[model samples]
Target: MGLALKPTDTLIVIDLQNDFCPGGALAVNDGDTIVPLVNRLQQQFRHVVLTQDWHPAGHISFASAHPDKQPFELIQLGYGPQVLWPDHCVQASTGAAFHPGLETTRAELMVRKGYNPQVDSYSAFLDNDHATPTGLAGALRERGLGRLFFCGLAYDYCVFYSAVDAVAQGFEAYVIEDACRAIDLHGSKAAAKQTMVELGVHLISSDDLL
Candidate 1:
């Protein structure tokens, strides 16, 4: 029964939205690869949560909003350096919707983040400012979810931040590498792996669970 999960553990699916999928805006490399595995993993956890990067149309993270700025341009935001993204995941738009094709059987809660036009929220726990919480950590705490298993798009961004923040918030966090995809920003994948290792995030493949 090792790592088979319990009522005290949670499966957190981060940013499984249309804009992050293959062929969508801001699509991650190999983003489609992990969907089926994540869908399958859903059956193994009783408390499953799904996160959506639900940004407004004119989000501050968008380079287009800054006129001369291009996608991936570095910008100064409150927390520190923030990358400008191509316009994506505009709230209430079709691209912001979760992939309906996913097997979301165990998803008990859906957490929506980045609704604020002024801030970009990569971590499911806290917005980049480290000021406003998305309330996810408290939700997990209230539910007594000590062991957090994370999956989803772009291993370099949302998934990584969420996993790191989970551990920082006192939840034992595991990142299912095989259940996550990467944006791979010019060796960022390698860097992200190193960062996770240093953060004490357990890296497990999907096959480890199966």
Candidate 2:
């Protein structure tokens, strides 16, 4: 059965940035392939929000910031375990910009995350510490947008976390699976989907909406 998008429902395009695409510093395999579908999906929603992974140079999530560390290694932080990543998406850099082919004109709001050098932000609603609010929740609430549909980037990380956070923030969350790609490090994609499903996130596909 097809899902009809309500006017009050919001579509969140997560981290469709240069760094997460092909030829980027930290590219997800075939990440660029989803851009056209995402562009099409956005048109079905009356409200659209775009998120960017706007990190600063030497951000805490980068392996380069930690001596002798390499990308994908896990380390414990004040909040919990953290995954260090390759240097990417620095502020004011090409990698931080939206994917060149992504349609942004339909987006009513843009949320930039991971700018805080002390923490890494995967969820569009909250930083990884699970304390700091990125203000996305409040913004959506104020606009009366309660149901959130998420897509874009690595399905195992940002997209997964965002959908989880959306449910936690009192919004109905759905993941359009076919509209996303995944890094899938060590079965992380499978792990993320299970967690999201357990947490009340609806895992659907682009065909469900379009």
- C-alpha root-mean-square deviation, candidate 1: 1.4
- Residue range 42-119, candidate 2, lDDT tens digits: 889999999999999999999999998999999998889999999999999999999999999999899999999999
Model 1, residue 64: C-alpha shift (Å): 0.8
Per-model TM against the reference:
0.96, 0.98
- Evaluated at residue 23, the lDDT of candidate 2 is 96
Candidate 1, residue 65: the lDDT equals 93
lDDT string for model 1 (24-106, tens) is: 89998778778889889888788899999998888999998999889998878777888999999998988888877777667
User: In model 1, which range of ten residues has the least summed lDDT?
Assistant: 1-10
Candidate with maximal lDDT: 2
Give the runs in model 1 whose Cα sits over 4 Å from its true position: none
